[model samples]
Target: MNTRMNSTASEAAHQFIVIEGPIGVGKTSLARRLCASLSAQGVLEEGAQNPFLERFYRNQRAAALPTQLYFLLQRAQQLAALQQQDLFAPLRVADYLLEKDRLFAQVTLDQAEYRLYEQVCAKLDIHPPKPDLVVYLQAPVDVLLERIAKRGVDYEQRIERAYLERLNEAYARFFHEFEAAPLLIVNAASIDPINNHADYEELLAAIRRMKRGRLYYNPLRSRGI
Candidate 1:
C-alpha cells in the first residue's frame, strides 16, 4: 500500500465490497484504490500466478480448461483463507467474485470440458463469503479493447476481440439477475476513477452512501445537462 494513496478511512457503509467487471474494465485497479481509501484489507486474486494464462490467451480452445481450473482453485483458496480470518476485521475489498469463475468456465470451455469442470467444482464445494456490497463496472467493447491495449500486458494483448465480446455479454447476463447482495453498477466508460482524483472521490462518496438495492452510477445521466 502506497502511503500517498492512504487517506482517513471513509467509514464505508459496507464492510465487504466486491468489485467486478469484464477484463480490462479496471476492477483490480479500482479495488486497490478503494482498499487504500477505505483502509480495508484487499483479497485480490493472483491472476499472473496462473501458469496457463499466457497459453490460454494464445490458444483459448487448447488451454481453456487448465486455465479456468487453475483460476478456480486459486480464487477458492484465497476466499477460503478470507473466510478463516476474524469476522470483525476492518473493511475488505476483493477484485473478483467466486461466482465469476463459473461464468468464465461457461464462456471459455467447450461442452465436454464444461462437464468435467462442473464435476471438479462439485468436488471442491467452495463457499465464498457474501459481500455486503457489489460494485459492478460496465464499459463498451471498444473501451475495453483500448484499455487492454493501454495496459500493454504481452499475453493480454494477444486476447481476441471475439472472446472479449462473449465475456462482456456473459457479465451483462450474470449481473442482470444478480441478487445475492446490494449492487452498484457504474458506467466505467464514462468515468476514469483510477487516474482522476475528482472522479474517484465522487465514486467513493457514492460507495459509502449505498445501503441496499441496485443503483446505477452514470455521471452523464446524473449531471442532467
Candidate 2:
C-alpha cells in the first residue's frame, strides 16, 4: 500500500472524477489531462490490451461473453483497489464506470448470457466509490469513426461504422435518464482538449462550477476559444 498522506492542497476537492464516453470519444485523454491538471492520481482502463478484444471485434457473437466477462472482472478488480485508496486525497480520475459494464453487455451479449453475467456481477462485492463529477463526452458517429481510424489501432480497425452508431445511441439513451452523479455532457465533435489549451480550460471551468445534477456543454456553441 502506498501510504502517503492525502495532501490537502493536492486533493481535487471533489473526491473522485470520472470521464466516460464511447470508444474513441477521448475519455482517456480527458481523464489524463484532468488528473495532471489537478495533480491527482489516474486510474485508466486497459482497453486494447484485453486478449479477447481482438477476437471479439472479428466475431462478436462468438466472443462477446468472454470479452465482457474479462472486462467485468478487470473493472471489478480496479474498483476494489480504488475502494481501498485514501479518500482524503485531492483527486482521483478514472476512465470507466462499473455500471457502464452493463451497457456493453446488453449491446453484445444475448439475453441468457446477459442475465448470467448480471448474476455474477451481483454476487461480487465490488462497489465503486461514487464520483463527485462524471464528464460524458458525445460525438457524431462520423466523427467517432474518423477518430478511431486516425488512432490506427489494429484491433479497432474491425469496428464498423454501424456498430459505432448503435453504441452512440445507446450512450445517449443511457445518459438521458442517468441520475447517479453530477453529469457534465460535452459535445466533443469539434473540441480538441489535448492540443487546444483554451478548450481544455473552458472544460475545467465548467467542471469547477458544477454544483449538482447535470449540465450540458457544446464547445461549438460556447464563447470564443
Candidate 3:
C-alpha cells in the first residue's frame, strides 16, 4: 500500500520542497526518495558535471574560483529553466538551495576570488522560486565522514576532515538564521531512512504535515527500528 495516499491534504500541503545539508549528509538521496514517494518532479544539482570539481577537491586553492563559478552558473541556469515552466505545475523536489552556492564560495574562496564571485552572482541576478518547505539535515563530522567513505566516490574520498568540519559549520550557521520558508531541522545521524521503511515513512509523514514555522525531528534508534 502507498501510505502517502492515505493523507491527501498533507500531500497537497507542500508542492515545492527542498532538501539541504552538508556534503555526505545524504540530502540528494533523501530528495530522490521523497520525489518517488510524492510523485514529484525533481530539480537536482548535477555536481559531477562540473569539470573542475575533482581538481578543486584535490587542491582547493588552485581551482576554487573556476569550480565555484562553474557551479554558480550551472545552478543559476537550472533555476532559471525551472522558473520558465508552468506556474501551476505539479510538485517539485530539489536537492539544493541556490543560496548554498554562496555558502561554498564563502568557505572555499579567498577575499579577492569571493569578491569576483559575488560580482558575477550579482550580475546574473537569479531569483529562485521559494520552496514551500525546506528540510535541513544535520549530523556529526564523524557521521558525515563515515557516510562519505561508505559511498566510495573517487574524488570525494580525498575530502579532508578539516574541510568537512568547516563546511558543516557553515551549514549550521546558515540554517540557524534561515527564515525564508517553513524549516524542518532533522537529526539524520542515527536513522537510515533511505533503506529503512519505518524511518522513511515517519519522516515523510512529518514532512507532509508541515505547513509553517520551524520543526525539529530527532528520531531514536530505540523507536523499534
- The candidate maximizing lDDT is 3
Query: What C-alpha root-mean-square deviation, in Å, does candidate 2 show against the real structure?
Result: 3.4
lDDT of 2 by residue, 63-149 (tens): 999999999999988888876865555468899877789999989999999999989888986878889888899999888888889
TM-score of each: 0.92, 0.91, 0.94
lDDT of 2 at 183: 96
RMSD of each: 4.5, 3.4, 3.4
Candidate with the larger lDDT of 1 and 3 = 3
lDDT (10s digit) by residue, model 1, range 1-225? 334334344453477899999999999999999989767899998888999999999898999999999999998788889888864666799999999999999999999999999999999999888899999999989999999999998899998889999999999999999999999999999999999898999999898878789999988745334
Report the Cα lDDT for residue 72, model 3: 93
Off by over 4 Å in 3: 1-7, 223-225
Decide which is better by TM-score, 2 or 3. 3
Ranking by TM-score: 3, 1, 2
Model 3, CA-based lDDT? 0.91
Q: List the residue pairs that clash in candidate 2.
A: 11-90, 12-90, 12-91
Runs in model 2 with CA error above 4 Å?
Answer: 1-13, 221-225
Model 3: weakest 10-residue lDDT segment is: 1-10
